[model samples]
Target: MDKFIDLHVHSTASDGTCTPAELVKLAHKTGLLAIALTDHDSVDGIEEALMAADRFQLELIPGTEFSTEYHGKEIHVVGLYIDYKNKALTDQLRQFRDFRDHRNEKMVLRLQEEGFSITYNDLLKTFPDCVLTRAHIARYLSDTKQVSSISEVFDKYIGDGCRCYVDRPKVTPMDAVSLIHQAGGTAFLAHPCLYKMNRRELTAMLDELAGAGLDGIEAVYSCNQGSDEKDFKALAEHYHMIISGGSDFHGTNKPYIKLGTGKGNLKIPYRILENIKTYHQKEK
Candidate 1:
């Protein structure tokens, strides 16, 4: 049997629908040899996932998906095999996390100003202990019948400079690379094609990130359109960087993506992780 793994995944510690233990249980059930819990802006789910993976004897990489800025767009950087317990890692993460809390608060106020019946208190009441990313806000709006759908909420209101959107303080890609490396982990740009960059623009960004000790590229993804995977793989080779892949599963929040086999055609071979381990060893 060929072993497969998901390098990117999410749980309720961020915006995902499933809890940490549930993600591990689901990954084990789906026959995945490993899965990295790269929850957005949070590593809170990793502990429970680690315990669950231990029960199943599966490998769960403690990882995080941090949002960084480039020019004006939001860029996500994924850190894999991180020492999640490292004080330097946790402290910096916590410091930046307060920005998210403030952003959410301001967004709710902006939405209310636009005559939407939302508030920070109501948001917390509905989703206690959940990181209130834009996804959660969109869901709250849709569930309250304020928006026809989650997509509608973004289209009309809070989709990055829409009427109610709020930007966090800038954390550049270089900053992200430094943080991940400080935590003794490998950093990869997640879903590069989705950044809406032309080849020239994308390559330029990759060059900039590479200089900051970026270790790899997420060359395979569930949502990759034609030739995207091939092009990304070529870039990784051209840059002498490692390659990684994942489904970017969010459970019901992103119901179309499946673990291990994403969108019915995605399969990440275990050799990718083997290569990552080899590179990580050499670098250390």
Candidate 2:
């Protein structure tokens, strides 16, 4: 492909180390045609990204990764080409931030009770741009030497069902898709393989999401196995959905993953996005 785009990326607005401006500069220097700032549960960075994208002459897709749930398991729904200023989407994101803040407070308290020195305010100050995720908290813990690494923090405390883990109020995947569509964005399932569900379970979730007007799936990802792209593409074809791809870049958080080219070998052609626009236009 002559050009490439990374449809999923994070900024310090949510769990990533790079600021929005820095991410845009890096994408430009790395020779990417475009990148989507799909920060976790937040679009606070989109404005800065847009400004920098303009200066660098690169496309910046304003997006967010919505945290949703199905049968109590957390699922991420990515919204691409979003209008971050849309009141409905911003209002809902505010609500999500509030819920997550409550959950983060509870989590911090639980950790403090277990003799950790971390506090909720520390996390807020540390991750000032947007809503704080466990990834942010993990970095705090890791930086403090309470944990050797972020991975260790999750393994011992905040991974799902861990003692320090607290569940946020659940937003269904279907509801997420609706909100994305309401905001005039395309909704996609992000990194399905990471969900670790069997084919039957995955299909059922897709069916559920499709019923709510989900437009596509993240068929290509930074961590795809040798055959994963082929398998995921076939799955998307089965559901008549467009295929999206990304590096899921988290800056230093996932240091090995790169923008546009994920984990060194993942390449997402510009046409994938063209295809998305084409598919949605026909639907309209």
Candidate 3:
């Protein structure tokens, strides 16, 4: 069997439903040789994941997914093989968590103003000990039958440009790239297709990020079509950036995306991890 690796995943330390230990067990059961816990704006799960990796003899890369913005669109940047103990990185992530907490509170207030009977306290009760994300809010709305589906909640509220949407503070793309470098990691644009940018626009953005120290682009992703993967691979080649991929697994928070195989057809080779490490070594 071909060894596989999932470079983007999440655990309960963030919005994902699985704990770090549980995720590790799942990875082992799923036959993943390596997996990175690239939780949103937090490395709190890294130590626990590291312990689990050691126990299972699985490769675990310490990573984080940063929330960034450009042209008012939310862009995500993933930092792979980061030094999770780096003080500057940890301090900034702590600030991000604080901002997320405040943003969640604001969203709750906005929902209440829109005549929804929800509160930040209710969210905490619903998703105890995990980051209060829009996904959590959507789940609450769906579970209560206030929304027919999770997508419906985003369409009617909470999503960007929706009535109850409260934008979270974001770092610039350049700043996000720099933070990854400061943490001794490779920065890659996460899921370029999700930006909803056309070909020329996305290329322009990638050119800017490439100049800002971006090392790769996510050419293979759970949500990407085959044509999108081909286009992204071409873009990566055009910019001389490494190609990277991931399942972007968030456990039950994103039920369709599996750990190693996303949507049942995704297969990211272990060589992608080796390629990244090879580049990191050369950068040193």
The best candidate by TM-score is 1
lDDT of each: 0.90, 0.89, 0.90
> Which regions in candidate 2 have their CA more than 4 angstroms from the true location?
none
Candidate 1 residue-wise lDDT, 51-157, digit = tens: 99999999999999988999888899999989898898888788777888899999999998988998888888987887778889988998999988999888988
Model 3: how far is 44 from its true place, Å? Answer: 1.0
What tens-digit string does per-residue lDDT give for candidate 2 at 119-144?
88898787776668899888899888
Winner on lDDT (2 vs 3): 3
Q: What digit string (tens of lDDT, one per residue) describes model 3 on residues 83-119?
A: 9999999999989989999988988898888888888
| TM-score of every prediction relative to native | 0.97, 0.96, 0.96
Per-candidate RMSD vs. true structure?
Answer: 1.1, 1.3, 1.4
Q: What is the lDDT of candidate 1?
A: 0.90
What candidate 3 gets wrong by more than 4 Å, as runs, is none
Q: What ranking emerges by lDDT with the best candidate at the front?
A: 3, 1, 2
Order the numbered candidates by TM-score, best leading. Answer: 1, 2, 3
